[model samples]
Target chain A: IPPPMRPIPCKPLFFDLAGNHISYPMDEIEEKAGTSKKSPKKEGGGITGLVKGLWGWGGK
Target chain B: MTTPTAAQQKKEQEKQALYVELQKFCQSQDDTRAIKVASKILHLFPNDEVAFKTKIVCHVNRGMFAEALSLINDTSKLSGSVQYEKAYCLYRLQRMEEAKSVLDSWQSNSFKKVELMYQIHYRLDNFESAYDSLSDLLKTSDDEMDDERRTNLSAIAASLKLAGSSRRVKDIQ
Candidate 1:
């Protein structure tokens, strides 16, 4: 058996719609987009919240 | 008992009609039409989960991950599958760590989750773990393994075996 490998710190590579491989600096993108710091608050409430609670049907 | 006002009845009928149209569009896999109907429904009922989910699927199918992510972010409450979809968007965007973190946060046993985990582990160069995940997935009944999934498992297995043997040969040399 091959010895266990250590996890390497590497950036992930994404594919575009054209099936081209592209590398992105996610940390910088997140920092600039403000997603790295905090998530946005969800909108609406009550019946909307209740309705939005259903799962696994159309979104699959 | 008080009867619904004319306007209320009209609104209810419209909602029902929109839902019917949405279902038809989705069933036909007409994502563009489905999205349009879903957006209309969502506009009228912002919290409609089915419409939101339909819209998300349409965006994802079109490879609009950024749009899908944005929609997921706008939602306050996420259903299990929606969370999975969000993680998938992250994974497709090449935010592997973020994708892993999201999947980790959710205590799900979905095949999609397993597949995503396998991909993430493989990309992270954790071949052993990746192989283990793929093995677990393959162990699912043959009926559950579609042609594409079976092919993917075989390909990953071959790649892992090639890597392992090459490493061993280097060690021997």
Candidate 2:
């Protein structure tokens, strides 16, 4: 059945090494939900990679 | 106890290497090859938790619940718990009572668990409890999820009403 959409999908939950339950990461969740923010057309050959790299450092 | 001999140590090393290959296969979505590598690891070490789980996941992903259940049943112990997965397999197999009991065994609540319980209750024609479960889900959820669950709650309510009406009609008959 196609489940109702949520902040997270109602699926398997796993534990981290420390044993705290964790759901799927946002990117994987988005991808599974077909609502990914990634552009369909790749932006340049590698420019998007560079931007994501910069964002990962600054955003965190 | 005697220490593991060199041959046993070498076998352990090979198992570790196969696990690495299994990881790569899983990441690449090569579940077929991943299952083979995981089976190899399991052959070398039947008590391997990672290999057992990887194999189960591959089968579950393929919708081969029976195969996954076989693996789960054959193993006496899994280093990591696969209780939830076992419930899912039973649910898919249409063993509602078994599935419900497995879920009931859980002490804590999660969205998936509650949702599944709601489904199981609905299938068993226990509309009242199904509605209760959905309402519980509705109250706990927030924002985007709340709307969807509210809709589900109403649907379950409708079912509850329908079941009541049917019972009333039966009494009249």
Candidate 3:
């Protein structure tokens, strides 16, 4: 892995949620390292664009 | 005492008993019953931490990767040990990049370094490196693993053998 490819370690938000690391895109994350099969579903809202739908209305 | 009131009380008692049993099952390392119990609990209290984690672990163990991933995404109380379990589930699913990202961001040192290296190498099919790194990890670690870790080590060793054989066969072909 190149140094440039290394994701920066920092916490960011996905719309309403807080403390999520917003370094790389979820697709890139899935491509490079892979993802869990039952990933969280995106709620019918905008925040799903952020942390791969880790936060949304459906979670509740 | 009215019969209806008695029946309601019994139902509540049953629910409470089931909840206690679910908690016990969640704490136990036994995946089979734990999964069943957890799933039942989730059917009742979907956000319960123990139940959610147990369900995710069970699904991942069963290779229900898509279900496990969806649950991980949906549940919020799986904030601690459950997160580590989710990471392992991700690895089993072959979502290496997401697995790596989650593992990297995790607060637990347990999933760091060697496992990450091995996972990366495994995803890349760099079997030699994966085996060597895991072997190195066993060599360096001071913690004594009981039956389960030893069993996983055995499996990794066997896979390494198979990987080596296949590589050789490929060369011959």
Candidate 4:
């Protein structure tokens, strides 16, 4: 029987504008996405946590 | 019909000689020399097919993607090969979405097209789709597969394996 499929944890590789291969670290990407070092979960004071803390009553 | 004048005959002979020289340079893979001769030919016959193709190839080999793309744009009634080169230039410029769109529009089944499609899907994070395209390409007769194709197939397969193993390990942990 064929082996069960699994998702790969490989970093995505991209060709730069000059056709050069490049890959970015996941943490650096997440940081750029505003969810790593400064994530609300980490800081416990961002908009995400604030909303969660206030529950749905914070806003519709 | 009147016979050709001596001057016209001489000009035709010179053109033919230039074409022969261009063919030799191209066959030798001396792109720089080929470009020089091709430019001269283009100077005399602005729309010469051989000269145009040679110039575009020289530009591509020199990594002048923007120049190649511009030349392709300036051309009218693009041939299939020219369209393929245009798509290739877009791809090399890291315009993945646009490259994919251009490639999709072409209906021919060619090695370059398959290779480009694999790259586009792989870059889009569609690994399975990428693998599918690659496997389809590999299914062609061995005689038709060149060294580059073989290398690409192996590289992608190895990468897929590594990804799969890492995912499985994470699951186990």
**Could you tally the backbone clashes for each prediction?**
0, 0, 18, 0
- The top-ranked prediction according to DockQ is 2
Which 10 successive residues of model 4 chain B have the least lDDT summed?
A: B164-173
- For candidate 1 chain B, which ten residues in a row score worst on lDDT? B164-173
lDDT of 3 by residue, B72-134 (tens): 776655645455556656666777777767766777655244555465666666667655666
Model 1 ranges off by over 4 Å:
A1-60, B1-6, B78-81, B144-147, B158-173
What is candidate 2's CAPRI-style docking category based on DockQ? incorrect
List, in the given order, the native-contact fraction of each candidate.
0.00, 0.00, 0.00, 0.00
Question: Candidate 4 chain A: minimum summed lDDT over ten consecutive residues — where?
Answer: A16-25
The residue-level lDDT of candidate 2 at B157 comes to 59
- Candidate 3: where is the Cα deviation over 4 Å? A1-60, B1-16, B19-36, B77-80, B111-113, B125-136, B142-173
Model 2 RMSD in Å is 13.9
Candidate 4 collision pairs: none
Better of 2 and 4 by TM-score: 2
Which of the numbered candidates is closest to the native, going by highest lDDT?
Answer: 2
Return the TM-score for candidate 1, rounded to 2 decimals: 0.64
DockQ-based class of model 3: incorrect
Candidate 4: where are CA atoms >4 Å away?
Answer: A1-60, B1-8, B78-80, B141-173
User: In candidate 2, what are the lDDT values of residues B34-98, reduced to their tens digit?
Assistant: 78987887888887666677787777767788988877887858823666677777877989899
Model 4 residue B29 lDDT?
A: 68
Residue B158 CA displacement from its true place in model 1, Å: 4.4
DockQ of 1: 0.03
Superior by TM-score: candidate 3 or candidate 4: 4
